[model samples]
Target: MRQTCVLLLFIVLTSCEYFNIKKTSPEAILKEELQTFNWNDVDEYPSFSECDSLTVKADKKVCFQQVLTTHISGFLQNEIIVVTKDISDTLVLNFQVSETGQLKLIDAKINALTKEEIPNIESLLYESLDSIPKIFPAIKRGQQVKTAFELPIIIKVN
Candidate 1:
């Protein structure tokens, strides 16, 4: 009787998942998921109404950039900017689209020569952005998210 009881207890303990398998807590699983998540990438890029029809991710991005460039170019072309020397440089515009679909300029990196030639370039860029159509914020994990972008604007004058 003693031998049989010991064998039964041993078998019961071995067959029970509580003793054999390791159980994970919800907090631990959540922490692991967060560690593996990529925060820098968004599932969908921000878009303008005109770009909303595009299906491909790359195409949508290209369309958004093209529209933005066009708007800024149009605004700048209307201004009479006279330069003494030929100026050919690129300006990097850093901006952000908020989750609420509002656009804001973070910074503008203009070369010394460009700034000397066009003192109001920053204001002009802001005005151009103001003229752009309403934008849709980026989407990540099915939630609207803010996104930052750096756009290069080429300034070429004869």
Candidate 2:
């Protein structure tokens, strides 16, 4: 019981900081204005989905894996700037996008990555993700659309 209380306290404290940072309610992302098909009309966009249930650690891995195999190829097709070989790196970032659609990177940690690595990964990823269609079909009546949504994004070079 004491453990539960501790967990509850922890959640209360970090809820706004970790997850809700976006302030983008499930409805907003699903809305027609943002993606055309709210979570109700989800058509499976490969990456990104209603996967908040995942732990921060798991979410990080899922996002990285999804982007690499699913979206990296598309991004690489574009202009290649950095010639750096794949160097393993991990980052934990807190971000929020305003209603105006401005994406922001609040905080990030380069576990084992260098300063140059961060930007390279960021630039390449942002470019590649561009080809991705950001939209999800709205759900209705407790139905979870079995779509392969993008998890959190993480880049690693070995």
Candidate 3:
């Protein structure tokens, strides 16, 4: 009957396994994934304290700080760079992480803060970010959410 055909059509349309498809990342696929993910998670990464937040979004909890314990030690041979030019010691590096947890540098800039006109401000911030060997991303539902991180590295010349 007509009712039977209409029912079959509705079931067929709803049962398509399209939305359940597992997406892969690549030049073209990567663009599509990023475009979709961008719309899904509108909430910012969870912060310990919030000034303007109405309710704490604790769902974005992080297990521990990213620790970089090896490799980037004095073995890397990092030394102080002299001021042959008007280079600011305060460097801000914006880094992005891929799905496989590889770091990709997006941008880096020299000291923006003028308080660095003080003594050894650059050395202190740089060492802290560099100290962590392995970077930890904010974890949500046991999945690593794509986010940018800032690493400040300063080497004391004196």
Candidate 4:
């Protein structure tokens, strides 16, 4: 009878999940999730009022870029830019949209020839960005996030 009781106790202890499975701590679980998460992607792209209606993420991004380019091009067209020689170059404008929807110009990469032709091109680009309408910041995991962009603008003047 004593041997039977000892055998029963052993079976019960071995079958219990507390003995067979290790408990996961909250910190360990969080760390594992963080390791698997992708940090470079955003749930939604930054947009203007006109782009807010789009449902697809890629469509929304394209619409945002189109609107921004139109606004900047329109602004630049209104200004008088005269060049002595034919000039064709691309200007890379690096800008950031803050979490609060504020636009800031980080850098303007203009070629030497373009800069020589237009002395105030940087300021012109900044002013054009400043004139853009209200922007909606990008979203990541249900939280608003800042995003940076590099837009290449072609400058062609004959």
The top-ranked prediction according to TM-score is: 4
- Residue-pair clashes per prediction, in order, are 0, 20, 9, 0
Better of 2 and 3 by lDDT: 2
Against the true structure, candidate 4 has what lDDT?
A: 0.89
Q: What lDDT is reached at residue 30 by model 3? A: 71
Question: Residue 66's C-alpha lDDT in candidate 1?
Answer: 89
Model 1, range 110-137, lDDT digits (tens) per residue?
9998899888889999988887899999
lDDT of 1: 0.90
Better of 1 and 3 by TM-score: 1
**Candidate 4 residue 109 C-alpha distance from true site, Å:** 1.1
By TM-score: ranked, best first: 4, 1, 3, 2
Candidate maximizing lDDT: 1
lDDT tens digits, residue span 11-62, model 2 = 9988876664446777776674656535533222222444434446456445
lDDT of 4 by residue, 100-139 (tens): 9998889889899888989888889988987799999999
Model 4 reaches what TM-score against the true structure? Answer: 0.89
Candidate lDDT values, in order: 0.90, 0.47, 0.46, 0.89
Candidates sorted on lDDT, descending: 1, 4, 2, 3
**TM-score of candidate 2 on Cα atoms, chains taken together:** 0.32
Q: Can you give the TM-score per candidate against the true fold?
A: 0.88, 0.32, 0.34, 0.89
